[model samples]
Target: MEPLVEENKKLKEAMNRSEKNIQRAHRERDLVESNARDLEYQKVVLSEHLATVKEQLRSKSEQLATASTQLKDASEQLEKLQKVFEEKKVLDCVEPETAPQPDGRPPRPDIIVKRCKTAWESFKSFNRDVVVTDATHALAVVQSHYPATDLEVIGGGYAKGLSEAKTQRLEDEVEDTAKKLAGDTDLFGETNGSGEA
Candidate 1:
């Protein structure tokens, strides 16, 4: 009976040790699972961050491409304007002596004033000539003594002559004004004669 009791006590001790080992294993498994969950959450956050960064990079790249294209276009336009300026310079040097010589450089204020004065004088001369011719024709028609029909014919001739002279003067003035304005544009750094601001 004493041996049986000692053997039973030994069995009880072995069962307690087995139960403690099983509990330890369960605790270890739970810790491992918790760590795995934490790692998975971190991976998800990192993935989202990476996606956001990639999107930003793509947007910046597109903007850079657009800016580069605009820069290229501006450079091309500048080249074209430079070419046009060079051609205009050559033409200016070859112009007649009577015209103002801009000399491919900005004209002085005094030179601009002189050119304006010359243009005004030309206009005044043309106007004086027209006035003289009209006066002469009027005097001639008034002095002529003729039959009523002939007088009418003479008056009509005078009217036609005056009208033609006026028209011709107007046309000449318009052409001269255009030429002066074109020169003024070159002196003032404005665009071509088409009047673009």
Candidate 2:
């Protein structure tokens, strides 16, 4: 009976040890699961942050493209304006007397007349809104070489003729008589008719 009782005690101790080991294994499993959940949450947060950063990068890239296009357009317009300025500079440099003429005796009367006519024509060919301003500049070139009387006779006459023609045409149109004209006369006409007989 004493031997049996000792055997039973040893069996109960072994059972308790087994139960402790099982409980420790369960605790370790729970720790591993908790660590896995934390890692998954971190991964999700990092992925969302990456997405936000990528969207910001995409938006910035689009803005840069738009700005680059605007810069290119402005550069082209500046180049065009520069070309126009250069052309005007060349036109301003032309001097009737210094310019080569067919008969070089103080620049023949016909040559001077031709130069004035060409200058007026060139002014008229410019944009209508800027025609007067451009004409004033072109006339300054003439004023530099010729006497004031010559400038008045040429530049003043051209300005007066253009203004009067425009005024007369507007008056004729207001009177409903412009359609009966012989032809569409230019600003400079041989006969100064107000689009009527």
Candidate 3:
């Protein structure tokens, strides 16, 4: 009976040790699973951050490309405008001298004014001469006297007496004024004489 009791005591101690070891193994497994879950959460957060960074980079690149195209287009338009302005400058350089060289320097403003005055005088003389010729005709119809040559010469010849230079200048002035009224347009818009912004 004493040997049986000792053997029973040893078996009970062994069973207790086995139960403790099993509990320790279970605790170790729980710790390992908790660490793995934390690591997986960290990986998921890193993945999200990386994706957001990539999207932002793509958006910025697209914006940069759009702005670059706009800038290039604006530069080309500016170049075209500058070229138009240069052409207008050249035209301005050629615009002032209208009359032939014989009537050039001394007769620029003075000759133009003189031609205008001559035209006015010729118009007034034509009216006055016609009135006189008609009065004479009415008198002749009432048995008065006047020459046909005088009427013919007075009616049309008064206007033909202007110098060729003055006549040419008057025509040129009309042409120049007409051309000036017809202006030019450019990229920005129209200008007075030159194609500037």
* Model 2 clash tally, residue pairs: 0
Ranking by TM-score: 1, 2, 3
Predicted candidate 1 versus true structure: per-residue lDDT over 96-125, tens digit per residue: 334444667744344554565566556545
TM-score top scorer: 1
lDDT of 2 by residue, 27-55 (tens): 99999999999999999999999999999
Candidates' lDDT values, in order? Answer: 0.52, 0.52, 0.51
Q: Which regions in candidate 1 have their CA more than 4 angstroms from the true location?
A: 99-197
Q: In the order shown, what is each candidate's alpha-carbon RMSD?
A: 31.5, 22.6, 32.7
TM-score per candidate, chains pooled:
0.47, 0.47, 0.44
The worst-scoring run of ten residues by lDDT in candidate 2 lies at 174-183
Clashing pairs in 2: none
User: Relative to the unseen true structure, what is the C-alpha lDDT of residue 101 in candidate 1, on a scale of 0 to 100?
Assistant: 45
Q: For model 3, what is the alpha-carbon lDDT of residue 27? A: 100
Candidate 3 Cα deviation (angstroms), residue 172: 52
